[model samples]
Target: MQDDLGFDRLLDDDGFVARLLGRTRSGRQRKPLYGPDLPVVFLVGGPGMGKGRLLGCVRHDFGRFVPTAHLDCGAPAVTERVAQRPELRSEVTEALREMALQFGKWQGTGGALPAPRLYAGLLAVATSDRRSSTESLVSEVREQDGLLPPGTFWRGVLSRAVRGYLAALGGLVATPAAVPIISAVLDELLARMSREGTAALKRCYGEYPGAGGSPELGLHTLAAHFQQGGQGRENAEKFLFRALREDIEAAHTSVTGRMTRVGRPALLLDRADNTLGRRLTRAVLEDRERGHHDRLVVLATARREDGGRFLHPPGHADEGRAATWQPADGGLPTWSRSPVGDPGLASPGRGALLVRMPLLTRDQQEREIARTQGSVGTGAGGQGLPVGPGFPGSGPSRLRVETGIRRLSGGRPLFVSRLAEATAAFRMPEEGSDWDLLDAPAGTRDEQEEHAVADVLLDDLVVRQLPEELPPEQREHWLDLLSHLSVAHDADCAQALMRERQAEREERLSAYRIAELLRDCGWPHCPRHFIGDLGLRHLLARRLYGTRAGGAAWREDHTFLRDRLAGEEEGAPDALFGTAAAHRMHHHLAADGAGNGHGAPGAEAVTNYLARTFYTRETRDWCGELLAIADVPLLGGPDDRRARALGAGGTRGGAFHRRVDKLLHVVWLCEDRARTVDDAVTSTLRLLLERLSDESEHGAEVLTRVAGEWSERAGNKQALLPCACTGHIR
Candidate 1:
């Protein structure tokens, strides 16, 4: 499907294996040692950061020479084991039965299947049986082979079947009984399989002999064996270690094929800090130390705190110069200085290199868009037909694609690729087309383009990272936070809002726990508060604000803005003030033009109110002084009655004076705004005073002067201001 997205190809081009192997090109084949002594290398990043893709590439490229295995550490088998308790027994029994059947089937098939295919079939059979018991099914398989005495063969069949069942269960549950039983059986079975099966299993687990098993496989050997396969316990472990040793030997071996005893494998662990628990980190370190191949090299990826935890000698490292291996000398590498850093550490070696993935330049993005669209059009046309009309033709200068890449991707490659895919699918028209640009007609080509891009991205790119099947309370929390953050334009403000939401969620969680405890003790539980993460809160908020069903009710019921206002003292003032001002501006603009007769006074009043309510005394005074000096057009022409009603009596003079007094007070209160405020306030006040100077003068000198001043202030000296005082203003 779509050439399997070519992930492997991308990784190959990116030199992932070469980097991992710690090799550089100086016209010599130099490979780093990889053995029991070396630390394990972990590639970590967010989902779709190409960790899995790089692993795939490594396997594909070195499957023959190095014997690589790739397994998803985050697989459900490892993560969901604790939740599968009730079904554990049944699951184990079913697994054994299926594996017995598979053994029989393999025998019947002459045992000639490819290792990968055989293992795949076996795994599939075991997984299927876990859903439904395969006792009868195994019998059927035997019967098909013309094997008689179902009773006589059933015992061994059942035992083998049980072993298989334990193997399946072992992957999911690390248990005393299951691990030993499954491990023993697997050891026997693996001894019987061809070399290919062994190799395949090795690749599947990413374990080599001297290299040891993945720490994700856990502490126990039996447990690891069962996790790997049901019938290959000892051999699996041996194969894993052997593969590691072989790879290390290969790396250190001279071109003449002689082994050179060098330092241990240079382990490059990336983002090891993200492991869910300390147990995992400990297990990985223990596994490496236990092997003791020679000259161990352990490289781990982690944030500073996480790395610090491991820098201390592991609890299990009791033997051989433990005192010498101090925390500081634990062979930690720092890569913070380099752009890409060493995926292995925070810093780089002298010959070490970093290749930070760069954001696509505007020109690069445009070219890519054009190339993608042109290719798609050409593919659709068949043969040598010209590509779509959107593709630029020969000209003095090539057309520039004006779409904002930063707006679309935030400089993330995954986001960029996703947006590019969406844009390509919709075939968005080239910029500056004759069609209306700002607002596209509903269901038109442009609308389809927008929808297509948003839909694909939201579904394929954004939604995958979310927790599985969010609960109602969690959903609500997510939505509320997202709504608040979405309105923030400043990056700092957005990040702060997110952090605040996270803190609030933690408090809510604590309250939820207290309520739950109360409920258990026959006390009334509060329904208002619950616990969850910020992501959950954001998700719920998004649904509430954007959806039709519960969205309206939720918005109306929740007083999030009021709550935020109450906590304004704890918030960043700049952000809070800006948000409050914007909200007020929006409300004023939306008020049906009914307030203060002419609406202008109402709008101006709202601005003044924001300056008073949200801003500090200094900011408020400065803003007030500026507004007071700003000119107010005189009542005239068709709207004269409305304007006159608004400016009734000494109300206009009072409003102007009151505003000026407020500005003066602000200037007096804040030393920072005093001198500047006078200049700003005086200019505006002078313009308004000029407007009401005289009738004849107002028509010519007053209006003309104001127009010239307004244009100059607006940085558009030739542009006319739309004056409500004019007859044609309405």
Candidate 2:
């Protein structure tokens, strides 16, 4: 069942997949290639945003074309390989060894990237003690030799190393055969390098306060210190990483003849922000800093945009920035690079390219929906027509269903795919609209055919990604906590919500902690917003509002926020025109507005707030505030509840009510811009301009300008697509 939810299982998007691989639609490689050419490319996105899925696609689609090996940094298989040793550095070595094995097994254009130097260094660390036998060391080296592609490079380097070690020993070893093969090889290489060549390794360990100045002892110290972490541990890790890259360079040179027709070997690191992964990435950056170049491209997945700060320094300008996959002339997604400086270098700036994992554009999503519907066919005794609104394959019905999906998914592939699958299996009545299907009763006798898709989506997108360290009960508590906090606008508001729930005790659930968890799980980080992704936030918010306490939890939560803000406003009266005021009115309307023929909440207060702030803030700023407050996703959709309540002019019959209503009507129109542009909405917009004109005639031109700005900012009418996923890269 879980395998069926695979992104490629339901959609045929090979063109997009090829684009991700830096290939043309016809699967030809792009020159000046960004995918395999770049030393590091980060695929950044939130959980269920398809970062892992993209990696899967790369392996499945392009494995034969490129010499690719994938290692999940978070997978226990990697760390478990060296459980007896139990060191992060050892885990990194194991990871590299696994990659080397994979590269050797591939029958592709790029041959194996043999890491003899790395293997020798690790072997030395394993057998540096006098009690260890030469036979064990020989066996270890021979074992690694078998995994590498057939080459004389290891034997030649090891033979030279053995000769050097014997000469240095000078009868200290009574028997020549007693000397360890790998340790001798590593020692010889360290000595063979020029002073400048070895200086970087020495400097890395120089900061470490540990003893052992010799190269063999240094290797031992580095691997040992990996357990006792600090600057010393990091330096040790970097030293080993540098050795790995050096080996890779030599290996690349050796394999150059075979790799002419292929791109560089790819190391796909999934969940690269994990402990072992971070070390590998940081080492690559440091290697690049020292002007070390290798034909090894690292394609890593990062939960954060700055590659979890390993790719770039803190306070980086492009932090949390995301862009659409705008394919260049080469037919690959255009990427942005931020140069990260290494302080160790005199001229220190090696950049990492950040490539956001692409979300499906609305057109692609609609196509996928249509495709799934066609494949699933009509249920029970119906013809093989697509199942949806109007007549089975009617345009209006398709459009309506697509619009609902856009609202629910915001173009997230997982959400869209699951929803499409569910829609295909369920047969709706001729009179029922897409909304009925989406907001169908969870436990009705007739609709008893389970909402399996929604459940799976919720689990995969939210619950399943939570930390496994959490007790089963605590996981539920945390989910509920996140659901309630999803309504929070920023860190402060989220922290406030946490405090109100008194949930900061056992789990230490705070804004920063939650942010960290969200990031680790591959969710976007909107510093200004909690649960950054809109679709995700809405999903959790839906759970909060619809499921718990029979819908009372929604009002109760909003009312708590309203009362909390009201208290804050009492102490700081001046904050009424600030963020606090906008948030307060947001909670006010969400909590009090029934939208069931009842009057809007605090209509007079809302009117006063808008009237006072309209002139002070810029037109765009005012509209932004209005949208922030008005764009609440109520159970009945954005329109029926919040929009209708705000648009309704209650008994405050005067210029104030009319003026506020006109402005709010503009907000609703923009929020629902994807829907059919009806005459009533258009007429309401014109009424706003006229009302603004009346104000301007009285020498108050601000309102008229504000209305125009709002309309223009909503985007031109004809260009407005069904939802926010309008940026299609075709």
Candidate 3:
């Protein structure tokens, strides 16, 4: 977070807090900030809108007030571990372990340890065998009431807790009136520790509490009494749990009061929804129901979608106050609150205020653009802005560059930041100075020109952000992975795609590094399955995939990704068809429409593909894109005028007849099934009809027959007007 990567941060702590806890959300009334609510706030934003950066800003500002416990909860391995094992110890305990250790190591001996590395894996001090030891402690703590303070680095906690409890309970346990037995046991154990050593004392703890010689032995013997199936084990366990919890809480409170003189301490959850969702939910509920976190302000960050659980725990309903997670009191509380939910969508869940981030304003845009310009060409695998003293250094040139970036980035801070970074990265794929790419205005710029710039930016950022710096030969595989991501449709499939190629790498691209690439490329947020920014994927698709030669190679690549996904889906074809239906349809048409080699077989494939799309419910979602690309003979678009020229230049023959037949089948499908025909589709159909109807007697005859069949099968759902095929065929 304290990196010297050069870009200036946009969100300021004080101002961001004002905006975050702002009075109005998109201009609607929200619940007023209240004392009863846990200081848990969800800072919500979409991809590249500075959500990640917002977390960084909070750490800078809020860490002083709240001795921050920072965890990059979305690290791929961390997320995987939770999804697999999901024990509370693994999620929150281990995280607290990391923070305590990170801060502890930072506070080592003399000076504070260096700020914890950003996006570093979750474990901090707990490494190698420590991982196993911590996990075991977590399980033991969960099942048994542990009085062992989780604070391993904080010296004297166990000593102090044991001593205090023994002081209160020693006489009672001595004659043992009502002495806090657990504390007395810890004291006895601590006393033995000066002579016997910690390991031997701890070993003595597992022995019989009734066989107590020392307080540690007394506590453990008591524990063993309950554990060995006696009556008061539950009460004993609960007391010990409370003791442990209080000790941990006191340790945290001790640190908190000393951290800052600010109003209250805050907890900054940096995208822990996927990993710590269940734990945070419980913590907040405990704080709410039991008034545990009343003194702390817990500010958690997450993608807008995950604000639901952050706002309220699961099984919670009836305002944000009630827990269906327990039992619904039916109909609900009049004092119910709608704290958490998508404010923009007005879907309130638990009663937490939602502050959804808006796109950058003009002033903010200019500030970012200026920052971009300064950072560029720093020789940092970055794209430097413009240098021309004539055009861009002046008024109109600056305006054009600002306008192009704004147009490309849509004022989303992340996109703009990366665009600046890419510009500074120094390798311009296009021929012009950065001027044309950055200068083109919204309407004045060529679509193709804007597209090329986006692809270059995507490539630049992907490479620059990639872990383990890819070499040239493996770069192709890396590019292929990027391409595959554009079409993978979701995070799991994308990960699987990476795993598929992970085995291919021996020298580099290990399995963990491949997964870590997700966070490296600014995907620390949830909903990772879908590309955080769709425009990035679209640009990658259009650039890496081309329309030359029917875009056959492009379709081949799409099909290649699709086939691999399908194979992975194995018996669950629905897994491929249901989730990524749009992607599959796009690829299927692209590949099936590669009607070059097979004559009748190709024609049948096209017909079958069209028929299924016409009848299926899933096809409705992507029919618009299908029609847009399917107009040409292959998956190529209207921009491929050269292909149009070649197709129209032909003399009609039997082979040509089949080609025309394949092309006309789309029109026939359109006539029978399309609810609407776009001007582009109609125009392309007209040109095809006009050309083929006059080609030769046989070509005309074949065209007439297909047109007749389509006209006969035409239904009410057909476009308001028939394709020109009807008029030309006769």
Candidate 4:
């Protein structure tokens, strides 16, 4: 129900459509990257990553000047409609109906959109229906009234076609049958069209399996060909989809394309990973590679990463690294060729450029905060208006909210809006400060502001988003299974846990099956990571630690994984970093409570693991691995009451145990950004540098650069302490 909140701005500045349309943010024309050939652009991200909202924004904002159409291929309404028409056997009919309507609305009277061609296809379906009569055919056309041109123009076109057809047939057509009348009307319309339009239609239809080189025959037999339902039908459907795009292109060229400026029609599809959407996209891509040319821009939202690989825009590839968003270098995202070959292509999707829909940037988050506070552009003095002081919308309060929300939401747009709205609406006590918001009680207190936000996120993003078609019992245990499995880093670990829990179920769940279910529900699937989204993973970790029957389930599960991993380490003694051993330590420390010092292997095990791998591994890779193993969410209740405690002062243990705790805190800062650097964090880095200095002459310098890198990624100012060993200060 929420509008895009200007996330559409991301798409307009040389984004998917902006690049295709050859326009900059200021509306100045630029040479299009794809030239006249439209490339399929995919917006890729995890669930709740705002793909749907971005598509909606594109349609709403861009539909004014250009012919734009949108369809949710997976929506219940669209699928239901398509299901009712088995003759079509796909969403093509439903999609074309939408496109025609949208195109008609944009062009108005005398519009050059191929309405007659679409009408011809509908007529084929109606006539092919075994239950159809002349009256039923009329009823079918009436049902599609909204998809046709204006009333006056349509009446004129139909009358002219009917009259011309009857005259050609002489007195034999005195009382024309509805079928023959409609067929003649279609033929007459096609006959009078421009040669370019006719050629496009013929080229598309000729490729149909049953067309036999006659576009006219293809038009009349489309429904019957689809009714067979096999490879032939699929091929026919492909050609038909191409024909639809061809129609759009032909219409645009004749009308918009003929003008002084060029305008391309845009098709925005949500959930384009669905079955019918895949077919449609495949048809377009295949046709393009086969040498078909058109000006119809197709932009789709995909929840899977493999739908497209992220690429930097043309000239900016050298500005920053590939496969990641660099907003500071001008945030233009696009899709590129897959790193893996065609054999490894994600099933049912390939050849399309995929750009990951980014989380809100820092600037975007601040803008949302200001908008939530009702502070528009500038004040009378040409300065920004006050965001107030001492209240929820005050500068300090907003910063606190941003820090907390960034930590909690990881900059997911929905979370940003929800938390900001909640903060703005909250009433503060006279003596209360902004810290009260961060220190709010956990979910046990349902009336607390923090609880409301957490509950909404839990239900909306996790629970309710589960595949509703799943059996009720499976749905019931899903959260518990996911919570426990969250500790798993890979499929092997996940399957180990699954086998342990098999005795509790009527049917055993494998890691593959669970992964499929999660993927179907829009969770990003990465082979190396069990749960990929940082926010969702953190939430699941919270549930694992807090929602068990005796609250001991967390330690028990960690103990189970730790013991299992220990056996693996014995089997694979040469595993780098003693991966299994390091993983075991992660679970062991979690089971014993981080920095709690009550574990079998003790702090010496962790120190040994680091000592063995720290010098051998690349610094960044080693840091990332260490962070991965240590960053378990053992903070507090669901509200994370101890969220702000990220230093050694609060950690109780021996020196090494405390160091492990501090290092985990620093790495977690990469994901859970804070308002500013705490002095304890800086001193912890300095202590780490001091330790590294003893190991090697240049080790301290390496640690300093690593700390600075973390600081940059985390947006943590003053975290890079003065290090005399490296002469580095920040």
Candidate 5:
């Protein structure tokens, strides 16, 4: 059986269970004088942190002593009921009927069934109520009863009957008058289960063919005919207590029966925060408190907020009081000596013992990979290599597993599972993997494999596990903000964007919308508020930059809008000049100097435009490149005819002088292509002055001093021209 259930074997390690149990027990010591009360332990963690695995461990190690019934609050039945609010009349009826049938089958077998038939019955009832098809229900029940006998059809029958009983019980509880009666019945059942053996209770609840009167009295008839005298409500209560006692005794029979008063059953509830509402949590907590008996414990798993739901309500004060194990300064408390007080017990870190589930260490991850892979093959391997071609190996290696973990899981369990699943399904190789092994492309086939894994583990399993009523908007909003934040360096900026979108009246961005976006974009929520990784940042940047509008036709039509406007404004001087300048700049930047080509005309036009507009130093950088290509002087000589014709009214000369100096400064400062600011400035200035008029002795010393000062300021060599005063002809 263990071999058939290979996955189950991995979870049967007692060490993990002991640690969990120890944490639960370390809190408040039970006082023997007052009698032992059931310990309510709540297990909490994010999705995929092993809550389910740990619960399985608990069931395996302490099933007999605890008689725990695991309930998944996120189950479809619970979620559907919470969501739609429809009365589960037929559903509940079918469930109870199924339970009764299963119970009967187990009894017929003398409780020799491999697994607990009663649990199987409960599951069947729950399954039936969930609107599962008859074939599906049968299949599920049969699957659960793997090695059980075929004639155990009575198990199905008894399971149905028990379902009916529970439905009736539910109906009775709905009424104000029968609430206490139902509560007492439940209390009695729990107590009796602790007293008598489960098999004995099954027999007492079993059908009596000749019994008459009310269905409740059928139990009395069964006891009278089968067990002789143990009947009626009082006897039923006693029988329930006896059954519970017997079950506990079977598990811990080594202990003296008299000392059993202090041993209580432990009820562990995992992910209780997923309750449809506070009402369910309160109801469960209250039931445990009212139904408290010696050695009976109720340990529930939930987020701290879920635990508070039970406490905040007025009626459940006592239940809240019982949940006194809270996280404290330094660490969790080993014992709570204080008395149970008002319902205001939930404070920050003041509810349950917070057993944090840390991320699996690298060593642990490697071991898990080795173990998982080893099961597939043979021999102790070093590690699984990364998947892909030319990964330094013919096949997968340990590095592949490590890379997969880093890429997929980011060392998170949930992520690891997701990444593993993705990598398992990943097939296509990214471009250039053969070229550069380290540069694995993201959002590629391999990346998608990683994302798909996260989708399954984190999105499907973890996020979906929340309660149905957890406001779809909130979820969407969280996902949307998370998606943006995960790729942004500034978390505050992402948050601002979310706030802005949310505040817009026309279309408020919903949480669902955000979640959908994140899913679509393959973005994951990072633990850090902002993302800092350059690779991820680049990916996000690409996504943002690559956003194109519609088809190529649409883009062409949009581009034509400007062209149409240009044709309509043919007479506009500003339009003509701007267009000409743009065309000239384009030509200058692209063309070679020969007049035979389009480049020379464009360069000449740009240089002329720069001279006419009196382009600034910054503009000169562009003009300089154009002038160089055009083979034109930026500044004319003083005695040159063009300079005389232009008029040196100090306006043109001063402007040209300022422009030349600024251009020099820019050349000196430019980082591209290696010229330092000083080098560029000196070179361009020297070239300009070489064409300067030799006769214009006006302020020659000033020009030389200016060039020298500028060069010194630029931290490069002095200009080669040595100013016009030197009389050195080019």
Candidate 6:
């Protein structure tokens, strides 16, 4: 198995612990950030960027020096902590009591206890037998050298409490009339259990007794008050939050009692942007604001976007607009409020830091490539031995393999690691290296991105991410979904398309497949689809269905996705104007080599779609990017064997000749990307004008209007140049 040794460098950043402990270099720690208040550090990045892995590294590094709790917010036990129903609340209380052992198990022992691991061990023992009595169970466990160690006062108390808590938990439904009493019993039990558990653990950790936790209020008193007032009895979930914090603080007190450790215990919330995580962090902050101070450090992970919305971290908000409207007179504008300021809030992450993880740089990527290659089970760089099929017997010459791996992965760690593993399995491309580099130059940045995503990465991704168990039919389904997703404007649009198709599935996609697929492609967590992971989308789309499919098949799928999206978007006219316009126009052209519209009522909508993109001011910039990538490959280059195969068009060259003709005809109609409205209208008008000229199809007046629109603009600089001719343009 892969080990924590791999992440030592990432975890052991100098002063990282000092930042949390507020320690000086002189072994004297001073409070940092929001003074003496325990800091809440947020570890943030985009999805699939390995936040969870970093959390694991943190636990590994600090497991010896300090106690920590790793809470998976998505887990049912954690999330149900807020449930209001009586039975659910009982279950929650029982879970928390069992969970308290995570920190409590260090009781009477002079050592550190990482919360999750301790509790997981205790749970294994406690759950090993539901049939045995409390004494018998604890005794049996002790006899077997289970997690619940014998000969300790707190362990004995904890064993009894666990028995009672479990009994009370199971009796909630059977004793329906006593639910309020049972609920109160559970809460009081949790409060006492967590408190005593921490108290027993409060001795000799790292230089001092940590958090000194005791029953501030007795279980009997709490139970009496809850019974008399009927307050805490109403919702057993109330104590869950209080108990969670108490346990952590208790653990801290236990570790640092009497002597000043000058440091706080830590709580690591995995997936902190999720339901339980967000609520827990906010609750703690709110408690602090309400003058309920506690000495516990918190570290959580979130997506980059949520780092601001929920946690209010600095540098997360827009600092300033690159294109701000300021007065030209060299004086401050009438506006007084700071753009990023929060009223009455000096700092949003008051005592915290939001550390954003960046992707691997080129040099780092090269090192990682070298490491992966060298570790491929046989000292992969050994001399005079071929690494795999087609490899040079003396190796591919140092850095050749590294360069190839880096180019394929773009330095994203997951991709780099995944591709590296695949290479180890076999150095030859699994799908076969049909991909060729774009040797020709392109004018725009988009083409370079296209080449990287489509030409460089897609095939490798397919071979890596797709599961071996994936059936052929399902593979085709996934391909169809991916290709259509290429044109999606946002997550919502993509989701809608997926949902519509999902309804037709006879069997559901497996969760593992869904997760892997989602990881393979990034959604619109940024500025819609353009700012999304376009490289992945484009590459997957081109490889799966774009270049591989024949003419008829390509046309069929594109047309279907286009019409389905159009129909799905029929209700929201105002919302569908700009983004949908580009999709509509492109898909319409894919199926036909005709004008913008083909005379049906639906054709008018297609014409309006193109018109909307061409004319709208706000959409014009977006339209240009869309049009820049828009391509129609009618025939291959002069050197292309496929083009040569289609010799003498309009003759009996069969499928090859017909496919070539169809592509050319489509290009003849669409013209080129019109930079301005007047220029854009000519795209449609050119087709109409030509149609009219050929047979006076829409009358001379139709030709006249199209001709007038063309002249009004600068006239087409390059003709699309289509013909039913045999010889080439020469």
lDDT of 2 at 603: 36
In candidate 3, stretches whose alpha carbon ends up further than 4 angstroms from where it belongs are: 1-32, 45-49, 62-69, 74-91, 97-185, 188-260, 290-293, 308-351, 361-367, 374-412, 424-533, 539-553, 557-627, 630-730
Instruction: Assess every candidate by TM-score.
Output: 0.42, 0.70, 0.45, 0.71, 0.41, 0.51
In candidate 1, what residue range of length 10 has the lowest lDDT sum? Answer: 433-442
lDDT of 3 at 150: 41
Worst 10 residues of 6 by lDDT: 721-730
Model 6 lDDT at residue 542: 47
What is the RMSD, in Å, between candidate 6 and the native fold over all Cα? 14.2
Tell me the tens digit of each residue's lDDT in model 2 across 491-514.
767787887786546655676677
Q: Write the per-residue lDDT of candidate 5 for residues 330-373, one digit (tens) a residue.
A: 22334332335543343212233333344454555554543433
What tens-digit string does per-residue lDDT give for candidate 1 at 165-197?
445444434433333332333444445444544
Off-target runs (Cα >4 Å) in candidate 1 are 1-16, 22-30, 33-44, 47-50, 56-65, 75-282, 289-367, 375-402, 425-452, 467-545, 549-606, 610-616, 619-730
Q: Candidate 6: lDDT over CA atoms?
A: 0.41
Off by over 4 Å in 2: 1-38, 84-89, 109-114, 128-248, 255-262, 314-349, 375-391, 425-455, 464-477, 503-507, 512-529, 568-582, 598-629, 636-677, 688-730
> What are the lDDT scores of the predictions, listed in order?
0.32, 0.56, 0.40, 0.57, 0.34, 0.41
Clashes of each: 47, 3, 32, 1, 84, 15
RMSD of each: 15.8, 8.3, 14.9, 8.3, 18.8, 14.2
Per residue, candidate 6 scores C-alpha lDDT tens digits across 5-27 of: 22333343233544454443333
Best-first order by lDDT: 4, 2, 6, 3, 5, 1
TM-score rank order: 4, 2, 6, 3, 1, 5
- Return the lDDT, model 3, position 191: 51
Best by the TM-score measure: 4
Error of 1 at 562 (Å): 4.7
